[model samples]
Target: MSSDALLHTPLHALHLELGARMVPFAGYSMPVQYPKGLMAEHLHVRAAAGLFDVSHMGQLRLEGPDAAAAFETLVPVDVLGLGLDKQRYGLLLLENGGILDDLMFVNRGEHLFVIVNGACKVADTAHIQARIGQRCAVVPIPEHGLLALQGPKAVDALARVVPGVDKLVFMTGAAFDWNGAALYITRSGYTGEDGFEISVPGPWAESLARALLAQPEVLPIGLGARNSLRLEAGLCLYGNDIDTTTTPVEAGLNWALQKVRRTGGARAGGFAGADKVLAQLDGGAPVQRKRVGLVALERVPVREHTALQSTDGQAIGEVTSGLLAPSVDKPIAMAYVRTEFAAPGTRLNAIVRGKPVPMEVVTMPFTPPRYHRG
Candidate 1:
């Protein structure tokens, strides 16, 4: 990692003015939390609304006659079926069936809008540019600020600012004018809460953030609580839970792959590793490993890379993401275990700091999602 001062988002100054404790994440200086602490921020978003600065994420636009066709060849998701203004979560896979990264793509009628993980954005953009540069125009939306307003009251809070945000359904995006600035607002988020991710030009990011924060039900949140909140929601952290070594099938993300994409056809078979992925789908590959939720028996929180052992002392899997879930008030973890040992209520043990701690396989989302589909 570069030792130089990390990159700063458009809202970096505002976070500092608000007394946030900044840390390096995804090569950018980001807020871990405000003086209010992680727990308060976590609960604030769960009950009301919390604004997060996520501008470190990369945004790209693919436009041309062949934009959709070109993009469809990169991921397994059915981009052609994506309706105008609708967004779908997808992954970029290697030719050997390994995942490169997971992303969200929106079909915007005349173009495609893509948002990818911050850490992998550079590499991801380069890969897409290399593959589709000849077919479509790939333009990076520079210095744009992405804000996430999440929680049950998010719609109410945002409606007070943007006026019509409540009408947008889940996985939909639109362009709106906010205080004289053109903004792109998407009704999507990672915390499993009903929320919107607003994209604004860098010049007006601070003003927009302040306006959203002025809402009585809105507060400023940071990355610390964001991780825990997503954990409780069972959302995967790109590099941690889902990586190059993991496939969508093993990561429990099969829903993201459309039926048409899975079937070998003129459009479906063109993407990388389509043969391997389609084979896995058709032959019903052995469930050797699967992502599962773990409830820790002890107070000690299990961290990533912890080895999971079967009841008889055989290694079955490893923890990918784990933390003491502040929202749930317990230690919850996500691990990939052999399919035979992944059923709910199956007994297992996680090695925590050299001590074997009892754990059990449980259904994910540790908590039910609160997405606003209607």
Candidate 2:
């Protein structure tokens, strides 16, 4: 897309003011880095706190009496039992047992608050409306701006601006007043850090961003660092690691599918692709491939779409996300290979530019997640 046609976030001007290099991402002109560069920004987030403008992501509300039940019909999650102020990750599935998109939904007492990927928001919103519009109100809140404050000190930085935010544990949220404007703050983030994602009115976005940046420990981070952070954390990127063709089971996201929504439970088998998904879950239809983490034995930076093969040279799978991890200081990747080759310590080769880069299947989250559960 052309630069002139790109949408801008509420903090666009602030990004430029901070010497950010803007790039096109998900149809928006977003900051990819700043004067400090991607490496520094990424390290800063791991050491301190970094504020990110994620307003391009979709925010919506599902309200009405049948919201939970109606929503349960679309995704394989235990939404009907979601506790007030608690959040859970879920996938929007296709009829063929594929993932339409992965999203985070929160039960906010009176309604359900949903946050979807920036690129998939339109399709997701439309799908939700078409399926359950009659049972509930599918109201997209484009007027709200989302910000993520992440790192070890994120709580300290955010609590200074929005008091009582420190009380929130991971996956929990509450409504708070920031400068008299209503704010919904959740203790959740994508970077595997102890952090908070704040939903603020669009008009107050810039003011809140500036306030957060005012903290001595906080710096404005951009998309470049955001991507690397999520990669190191073993989180899936919407289009790269997961998409319409991938199933939740194949992506190793089975833990997110609560047992209550699985076969033989009270709410079993009502979601899209339930039959196919449940079949795989129960071993009635075993998956041919499975997602696994790989650590390169060589220094080569294996990347997405890089083909994988067994030590003797038979095709196995392909890399979905990879990079020379900053924290681990090693080349790491995530891939889906034949289920037989998905075990830890299994040796494989990543074919990069016709040369073989030896890699071993290992566990994910190259770095341990630092979520504040208390």
Candidate 3:
């Protein structure tokens, strides 16, 4: 798409003022990094706090009495069992058990608030409307903008701006007043840190961002750092690590499939691709490939689409996302290999520039998660 046709987030001007380098991403012109560069921003978030403009993400609501039940049919999760003021991770599945998108949903008493990836939001909304619009109202909240405040000290910075946020633990959320505007604050983040994602009105986004950035512990971070942070946390990027071709079971996300939605439960197997997904869950039909974490034995950084091979030069799999992880200071990657080769400590080789770079399968979250579960 042309630059003129790209969408701009509400914080565009603020990013420019902060010397950010804009890049096209998911149909929007977004900041990839600021003057401080990717490395400094990544380290800052790990040590203190980093404020991010994530307004490009989609926000919508599912209303009416059947909202939860209707939404449950599209995912393998137990949405009906999600408690009020709590959030859960879910996947929108295709009929063949492939993933359409991974999303977060919150039960807000009268309705369910959902956030989908910016690139997939349009198709996701249309899919939901076509399938379950009659059961529940699909209302898009285009007037609101989202921001993620992340890191170990994120709560300290956010609590100072929006008091009472310190009381919220991970996966919990509540409505709070910010400068008299209603802010839906969720004590959750993608970076595997103790942080909060604030949903504010478009008009209040820049003001709220400024307030949080004014704190001593908070710094404005860009997408460059955001990607590295989530990679280190082992969180999958929708299109990169997962897509319509990947199933939740193959992606190491079986835990998101609740027992109630599985076979033999009170409410079992009413979701899309239930037969295939449930079969995988029960080991009736095993998956051919599985996603696993890899760390390069050599210092060379492996990149996406690099072919994975056995020690004897037999092609085995391919990488989906890889980088020299700033936090771990090592080359790490996420890849899909044959199920037999998915175990931790399994040795493999990445074909880089005609030479084999030795790599080993390891447990994910290269850096341990520090979520405030209390």
Candidate 4:
């Protein structure tokens, strides 16, 4: 796509002012890095607080008496049982059980709010409208800008500007008034660190970003760091890791499936692709592959699409997300392998360049999560 065709975020000008290297992502020209570079920005967020402009993500609202029930038709999560101010991860699937997009749905008393991948938002909105428009109003809040402030010190920094956020536990959110604008704040983020995702009107985006940056503990972070941080946290990127051809079970996201949506629950098999999903749940061997964590026994960093081969030289699977995990100081990757090789401590080789690098299947979250569960 041409640069002119790409969209700009509300904080585009601010990104330039900070000398950010802008790159095209999800149809938007976004910041990939800043003057501090990826390593420093990544480490800064691990120590202090870093602010990210996540405005490119889509924020939508479903409103009506049947909002939750109507919305549950597209995803495999228990949206109908979601309580007020709580959020849950969900997957929108096709009839064949392939994932369309992964999203987060928040229960807001009278409405259901959702955040979907930016590249898929247009189609997602259309799908929701066509499927459930009669039962609920699908409203896209395009006028809002989203910001994520993350790290060990994020709470202290944000507490100086916004009160009551400290009381929010992980996956919980609430509406608040901050600096004369209405803000929807969630105690969640892509990075495993404790943080808050603040949604504010686009007109106030720059002002709010500047205010947060003014905090001694907060610095402006760019997308480059965001990617590495999430990679270390073992989180999946929508297009690369989980996509139209992947199922939740194949992607190691079985935890997102609530028991209420399973075979014995009150409203079992009600969502899209329930047959295939339930079959996988029942251990019917519908999935031939499984996603697992891989740690390089060598120092070489293997990247995406790198082929995986068994110790005996037979092809197994391929890497979906790989990085030189900054926190771990060793190469780490997430891959899909034949189910037989998905167990922890299973040995495999990745073809990096032209040579093979040994790797072992291991548990993910290469780094421990620091979410505020209190």
Cα lDDT, all candidates:
0.90, 0.94, 0.94, 0.92
Instruction: Name the weakest run of 10 consecutive residues (lDDT summed) in model 1.
Output: 279-288
Q: After superposition, how far is residue 259 of candidate 1 from its true place, in Å?
A: 0.5
C-alpha displacement of 237 in model 3, angstroms? 0.5
Q: Model 3: which ten-residue window has the lowest total lDDT?
A: 258-267
- 1-374 per-residue lDDT for model 3 (tens digits): 89999999989999999999999999999999999999999999999999999999999999999999999899999999999999999999999999999999999999999999999999999999999999999999989999999999998899889999999999999999988889999999989788999999999999999999899999999998999999999999999899999999999999999988886866898999889888887899889999999999999999999999988888899999999999999999999999999999999999999999999999998899999999
TM-score-based ranking: 3, 2, 4, 1
Score every model by TM-score.
0.97, 0.99, 0.99, 0.98
C-alpha RMSD of candidate 1: 1.4
By lDDT, the candidates rank as: 3, 2, 4, 1
Candidate 2 local Cα displacement, residue 5, angstroms: 0.5
Which of 1 and 2 is ahead in TM-score? 2
Candidate 1 vs candidate 3: the TM-score winner is 3
- For 1-374, candidate 1 gives per-residue lDDT tens digits of 45366998998889999999999998999999999999999989889999999999999999998999899899998998889899899899988777899999899888999998999999998999999999999988966888999999999989988988889999999999987889988999989788999889999999989998999999999999999999999999998999888878788887888988877566656788777777776765564688999999888799999999997899999999999988788999999999899899999999877779999889888988888889
lDDT of 2 by residue, 1-374 (tens): 99999999999999989999999998999999999989999999999999999999999999998999999998999999999999999999989989988999999988999999999999999999999999999999999999999999999998889999999999999999988889999999999899999999999999999999999999999998898899889999999889888888888999988888995856988999999888888888989999899999999999999999999999999999898888888999999999999999999999999999999999888899999998
Error (Å) of candidate 1 at residue 127 is: 0.3
- Give me the runs in candidate 4 sitting further than 4 Å from their true place: none
Q: Please write out the lDDT profile of model 4 over residues 1-374, one tens digit for every residue.
A: 89899999999999999999999999999999999889999999999999999999999999999988888788888998888999999999888889989998899998998999888999999988999999999999999999999999999999889988899999999999987999999999999999999989999999989989999999899988998899899999998889988888999898998888885856877888888888987898568999899999999999999999999999999999898978889999999999999999999999998799999999988999999999
Clashing pairs in 4: none
